[model samples]
Target: MSIDLKTIKHISKLSRISVDEKRAEKLAGDLNSIFDFIEKLNELKTDNVEPLTSVAETTLKLRPDEVKSKNIREQIVKNSPQDNEDYFVVPKVIE
Candidate 1:
């Protein structure tokens, strides 16, 4: 399959990319070259080749979910610069 200037213009319109006449002509040539390379790849014989998914053979190790602390709210609030017993006070950031 080959790409033409008309097809490139249509593609540019669909993608919302502004393409001038000179650029569209260039795009047409570039797309045609890509398609030609793909066509050449399609001609390759790979009947016995296995489909590859990943280069590395690694498995993720998961740890059991458990809470380390039960009650530490008083200790955490003591370290704050400006603190309220219920929640930490923050400086006004938005107008």
Candidate 2:
């Protein structure tokens, strides 16, 4: 596929980019080259190729989940300016 000046201007508008006529014409040529390369790639045969999720062969090591700290809610809540038995109180802002 070939990119024209109008298409380049449209792309610039959609991307919120400012481009002059000279730059847009240059960008149109650049985009046409990119599409031509993609079209060339599409002509290649890769029916036997397998999709790859990762290039490296490795597994993640995970540790067993366990609680390392005891309950300290009462100790921490003592520092709060306003807190109830099991919750913190804050001023309401909504009407």
Candidate 3:
């Protein structure tokens, strides 16, 4: 399928984009060339080609799920605007 000037104009109007006749013609040609390239690719025989699962051959190594936080409670609590001994003091929103 190829894109025409009329199709480009309609698309521009539907997308609320302003395209002049000169620019619309250029866009139509560019889109037509892209479609032509896709058509050429479709003509190629890929009957024996294996579908790609991943770019890399190796599987990702996953680490065991575990808590890794070091004891930094005092450091974090220092940044709180109003702090209790071991909790955050915020304006109570719920009744």
Q: Which structure among the candidates has the greatest lDDT?
A: 3
Error of 3 at 90 (Å): 6.0
RMSD of each: 4.6, 2.7, 3.3
Model 2 Cα displacement at 87 (Å)?
Answer: 2.1
lDDT of 2 by residue, 7-41 (tens): 88898999999999999988988888999999999
In order, how many clashes per candidate?
A: 0, 0, 0
lDDT of 3 by residue, 43-77 (tens): 99999999889878788899999987889888888
lDDT of 1 by residue, 56-90 (tens): 76777999999999799988888767977976777
Cα RMSD of predicted structure 1: 4.6
- Considering lDDT, where higher is better, how would the candidates rank from best to worst? 3, 1, 2
Q: How close is candidate 1 to the true structure, as a TM-score?
A: 0.60
Q: List the residue pairs that clash in candidate 2.
A: none
- Kindly report which residue stretches of model 2 are placed more than 4 angstroms away from their true locations once superposed: 14-16, 75-81, 90-95
Please state the error at residue 36 of candidate 2 in Å. Answer: 2.2
Candidate 3 displacement at residue 24 in angstroms: 0.9
lDDT measured at residue 52 in model 3 versus the true structure, 0 to 100: 88
Better of 1 and 2 by lDDT: 1
